[model samples]
Target: MKTDKPRVAIQGIRASFHEEAAFRYFGENIETIECNSFKQTFEALKNKEADYVVMAIENSIAGSILPNYSLMMGYSYPVVGEVYVPIQLHLMALPGVRFDDVKYVTSHPIAIRQCIDFFDEYPHLKIVESNDTAACAKRIRDEQLTDTVAIANTLAAQLYGLDVLERRIESNKLNFTRFLILTTHENNKKKGPANKASLCFQVNNEVGALAKVLNVFCHENVNMSKIQSMPVLGKRNEYNFYVDIEWEEAKQFDNSIRQILKYTHNFNILGEYQQYIEDDSPKPQTKPDNTKRYITVKKIE
Candidate 1:
């Protein structure tokens, strides 16, 4: 049963954003194993059903996915890489359907939230939350739902043969989801040069304990790009600090980690991999009413 292509596990069906993120990281040649939930993706990796798991860690609009953070800590999988997929949601329906013909719009809950402003302009359209964006599109096509439309990506529209009624319907054009590429193998053969490191540790509750560890990063000239604190389950007033540090020189990161260990306990280096840096250009701010041009129907006074 050996195949040449690597099997990637994702939390949703094909054409979903998770699949898009997997394709972005592993290219289009790999086989995608769909799972009903994020936990299932990790289970697939654990059971040898998949070679890697593409899991969403955070989104530009929705902030961090806290449940996923706990899953990562529990599974203790190594994050080999990362990828950011732009959440360019589009409204699509049957080929001959028009905007006025749509009565219900369906998408994932998060996707629905991302386009709240667009929905506000069309109160007549009822919102239905689905498990996956692409699944919504597939359901519309499979069931021939003439009065329903789906909010999904371009891949869904093309795969399901639905015409896009509107493009980039998400409230913010800069909205994106950050997905972590995790694998069972800690020393993944495909890992590139490591400039970024993910670590989790606990510092005492006393004053300046957390600050002292951060000061070590500053003293070593290491850039701490992100820090997240999760409360230790069932423990009072105790937390586990998850930090991501990047460095220009490898020595800076090594020295910082060594120094921080003196100030932090239960220190674990989760992963060391090359950071995925999107364009460094300044992002333009998106207004709440940016989708005004697409407002065709007038509200009843």
Candidate 2:
């Protein structure tokens, strides 16, 4: 049982966006705990040490959080709610140092990759990996290293009392991170509307297997948002598909899964969740505001 404080386990320190998302969802009264990895968050929830787990699943620049997709499947936890955070990237360092003096950098791998443009120019500097971006800021502050730098946000810089060497170091300013708040419950029942539903499936080798799966949503006029294929863990001949679809199908019940089960051997309804974060986008003000376009993920070069 959760304590009276309602602990929420996030994958980083207090100023990390996952922690921010936890605070936003659970409120100020709830206590926040830190885990070293996404897998750890699941264990905390299972052990009843945390009431909820908040972690990012996708980013505007990095594309689908393919790793977390596997975590979601393995943990078998419900994708309870989604928190969208406009990720702001900034470079921070010890006081009075300029960007030119940044001899080394430490940050999350994904964050380093996202800010490749800036670092590529400074190829002479060594890049170190940290578990999270904000943690890197904490390291720079706690270690009190003058030559070392960290790539994070203003939030981390402020929390750790580091100087912003450069603001907005991300390759693209349109970057945003989508976080999933996971729980043990499988149902999508909530106090509000759910705009999106995630599903997973695997198909037998056939000429029109994918087309049949597409037809399931097409026939029902349910728009699909994202679809990705991953190799099945221990099977060389099979592949698994992870997909997100518009959430209108839940009201249709058996009518929906019956159509989907026609071609796929196994299918799972991940959950009917909502997208709460997007870059430069305002929160929907009314019910059924389907006017916004699905964020198209271009093929990674």
Model 2, position 294, has a per-residue lDDT of: 14
For 1-301, candidate 2 gives per-residue lDDT tens digits of: 3447666778877578886676556555666667777777777778777767787888888788778889888887877687777777888898887777778999999889989998888889999988888889888888888889998876677778888878888888877777888877832346466767788899987788888888877777777878899989899879889887774546553466687897887688887676554346353322212232112122222
lDDT digits (tens) for residues 172-287 of candidate 1: 99999999888987427655679988899999999999999989989998999899889999999999888888999989988888788799898888888889877567644321
Per-model CA lDDT versus the true structure: 0.85, 0.76
TM-score attained by model 2: 0.83
Q: Candidate 2: global Cα-lDDT?
A: 0.76
Number of the top lDDT candidate: 1
Supply candidate 1's per-residue lDDT for 297: 16
On TM-score, the candidate that comes out on top is 1
Off by over 4 Å in 1: 279-301
* TM-scores for candidates 1 onward, in order: 0.91, 0.83
